[model samples]
Target: MAGRRNGHAGRPRVGVLALQGDFREHAEILERLGAEPVEVRRPEDLRGLDGLIIPGGESTAIGNLMVHSGMLDAIRSFFYQGGAVWGTCAGMVLAASATTGPSQPLLGIMSALVERNGFGRQVHSFEADLEVKGFDRPFRGVFIRAPYFEDVGPGVEVLAEIDGRVVAARAGKVLVTAFHPELTDDTRFHEYFLREVCGSDERS
Candidate 1:
């Protein structure tokens, strides 16, 4: 799972899809973690990146932008080539193979079914400490107009859940979180994705 080398001085280059979402938040977090984060607005912006982050936003809007920009296939191809992808909130919806409550665009990267805004409206947003599989301590999860998985495929590994509801999962090199981990100070999730999913060296 070695990242495709882009000669960025040996640091792994991660791209944050900037079409419609809190892409800047994710990019800032990546920079603080010592990884170069590129804001990707076009399909060509995806080239030579080690990994990608699809941030939370309006799912339909992001999907429409992706299709219009002709980046849907490029994203799917990147995952097929062993690249790590982390999708949060609306991103979770985009990565799923199937979704509930009317159809939307999907990259079909992960074998799961998601229900958009499963956590209710923005007014119902909440925060909770999540017990993830590989984490020793609970990770703070910020749910803002989040989505949850109703069903996961055989290959998917459920990571974090709240009240028996699945909120985080991973399949192959793909990682998905229903809440916004980027909104918090905790960097464990990002470290896990880089070291475990992408097989890249974790920076201090």
Candidate 2:
């Protein structure tokens, strides 16, 4: 484990995919939450990570980078070996089994059919208070060119939604959000991923 190797002991070492997007924001959050945040730019960076976070950005660009960097198959193998993952916004698009509109490279780890930019264009971006499952209060969801799930296969648990559209969901150790939580001050989503998904006991 990275924590043990890096002398962090019980702290979980989480990797943030840095190929594109607001990876710095995610890294800051993970660091503030007491976990070691590692920027994963290559397939070899996946080693010893307790979990991975795919940040919000251009899905097609990020997908292309992953393919060229040999990170596609590497991440798949990491996931199958019980690695936890959380995908936000465009990351959700890459994580889904299939997407509407354009054909793009995907991790196909999450069992959901997603509609890219299902909300609208960038100008239509907006925020909403979402009632996320397992949370004591509503979460402020920041939707920027967000995508929504048309459907999720069996075993996938819907976490939050807006206007009856699925905005957040999870299957086993993998979590996905149509909105950006790192953009907001609330760290509940990150905390949940650390404590619940990664099985980390560290309290933020």
Candidate 3:
């Protein structure tokens, strides 16, 4: 099992899905957080990693690429084997069990119904200070053609919402966020994934 190294003696190895958008941003954040960020473009790239982040991009494009690259099943297997996974924006859409509007490829690990571009189009993009659970204060959420969960299953925990729309959630080792945390200077979200989710306690 590619589970988290809870008692590891060194920095945790984290993988960023580089098949799509904003991966570099995530990698940079991980580096700043004292983690060794690995760019995951193939199944082999997931080996020895404690966690993985699926970055925001075109859902259809990322999904199709995953299918073509054999990453869909690879990631499913990785998660089932106890790997922690976080999805942002379009990445959140890919993690959903079901999505409103046209169907697309999904990881279907999270028991949530999502709506693509729930907030509206690019012109409708906006920002807000979100009250994230367990956070000291508010998190600056940047929504760029983001997706929101219409409903989540009983096992899923709602982490943040705006106007009753679920924008962040977690189910077991999986985390999903509708907004782009990497766009901000705040490293709280990334730190949360590393320490809270991935079980890494190392600090830079």
Candidate 4:
């Protein structure tokens, strides 16, 4: 926990995988919470990061780059050493052990079996008011061709859902969400990730 009766605490550094999309917004949110968020593009970027965020993008592209740059092993190493990680939207896809389509390469650090595009096609992208645990008001989720979680491993904990489908999950220090939290100003989920995974300072 960060020191403070009500502000961030400690020298917390987080990394956002930059091999994809929507990382900047996540970084900006982290900055607003007084965390140092770095853009991670290569295996070298994994060093010194307390936590990592895999942003929403094309998961296949991100996975391919991670393999080519030797970052897939780097990420798995980070978690092996007890480092924390968060995955959102495309990130969730990258974290899964099994996905709906071809067996794409991944960090495979999470205990999830995910279904890509389970939420329908691009035109089916829609917003829904969600009630997430640990958040006060209903959170509006932005699902842009979002994937949904299915057949999670025993270690995973469901955090949020819609229509009986799992949208968010956490297992130990790993957090994943099928929606784009960065697309909204709602900071609860980010704060939760920071506290649980990143161990960043708290906000007032």
Candidate 5:
């Protein structure tokens, strides 16, 4: 999936948080898929990026950086301005409306409540073949110390799940995945994200 059709001019320039996460892999995937992916660190870094990806890592650390660096407010404002966002793993937790964890700052964009490391520890990482809706084949979902959406509201659309739990969802310009789609060989998830969320201005 590709964002927009106005030639490369309309192609989205995506940013992956490089503060402290698996951002390099995500950047590689986004670049390989044709989107201009950049690394984001501070509030100043948010400028010029069409959309952003909060990668999988220590959520609390990312949250601290958001508050200390003013990225939390910046990101929220970005969302209010119709910007597209994709969150993977810990990023999903930060994007959720609520979380069942200790006190920590959050961007809190999506209308979903998440549980941190709800799937277990990093050593418990596992792979699953997901039957994601709107895709032709099963998606190879990689969950590593992942967070899961425990309470999803009506505004959200459960795009992919496992054993009746949400692992990936979408709402308007916001897209999130509890598992790492950037880790898998299949590019369908990124493709769908680019075509649907990033390229959606025309459809709207």
Candidate 6:
């Protein structure tokens, strides 16, 4: 689906982690789809949101800011309460339970294990048409210093992959992509997150 109207009541209130990364891009996409986008810079900002997005940037920067701002626990509670979370690029690293190389602080909400910059350096960056689950058309995936899932827990379902490597995955209310869908015109992925993951919860 390209977009979904708030059939039941108000639009789903989605929060974008403003700690770092391309958070503004995500906010624009959400607003275009008719969902309320809240920029979350502090723990208080997390209140009264239906879903959240961790955008692509340096994972360490985002993680450190989250901890310093006391947003880590708040986010964990949000995810555990069935609030949907979508992590793009570096966001994937923070969302995963484990990662390749050095260990870093994570939300540890999803069951997936990710490898940071698994797609190689910026010179190796590329784009691919991904046939994501539940979408009829292929989605353009922009991989830039992206990370890929090396292992997934039992409950996790892979959405899209390239060259047999996991690039997108979902588990319960959480969704993650190694590529930056926000950088593209396609709002299908954001639509997918709101309609499917957020569901009918008007407050979300």
Error of 2 at 83 (Å): 0.4
User: Which stretches in model 2 have alpha-carbon errors above 4 Å?
Assistant: 1-9, 200-204
lDDT score for candidate 2 against the true structure: 0.88
Off by over 4 Å in 6: 1-8, 200-204
Report the number of the highest-TM-score candidate: 3
Q: What is the lDDT of residue 168 in candidate 4?
A: 91
Give the TM-score of each candidate.
Answer: 0.93, 0.93, 0.94, 0.91, 0.91, 0.92
lDDT of 3 by residue, 1-204 (tens): 123554466888889999989999999999998999999999999988888999999999999999999999999998877788899998899999998889889999899999999999999999999999899899999999989999998889899999899999987788899999999999999998987778722211
Model 2 C-alpha lDDT per residue in residues 142-162, reported as the tens digit of each score:
999999999889888899988
Q: lDDT winner among the candidates?
A: 3
Residue 5, candidate 4: how far off, in angstroms? 22
70-157 per-residue lDDT for model 4 (tens digits): 9899999887776788999888988888887888887777777899888987899999998887778898999988998877887887
Cα lDDT, model 6, residue 184: 94
Q: Which regions of candidate 5 are displaced past 4 Å? A: 1-10, 202-204
Cα-based RMSD of the predictions, in order? 3.3, 3.7, 3.7, 4.3, 2.6, 3.5
**Going through the candidates in order, what is the number of backbone clashes in each?**
0, 0, 0, 1, 2, 2
The CA lDDT of each predicted structure is: 0.85, 0.88, 0.90, 0.82, 0.82, 0.85
lDDT per residue as tens, model 6, 37-128: 99999888877788899999988778888888888888998877667789999888898999877977899988888889898989999999
lDDT of 5 by residue, 35-150 (tens): 88888877777776667888888898888888888889988887776667888998898999888888777777888889999999988999998888898888889999988998
How displaced is residue 74 in candidate 3, in Å?
0.2
Ten residues in sequence with the least summed lDDT for candidate 5: 1-10
What are the runs in model 4 whose C-alpha is more than 4 Å off?
A: 2-9, 200-204
Q: Candidate 3, after superposition: displacement of residue 203 in Å?
A: 24
In Å, residue 125's CA in model 3 sits off its true spot by: 0.8
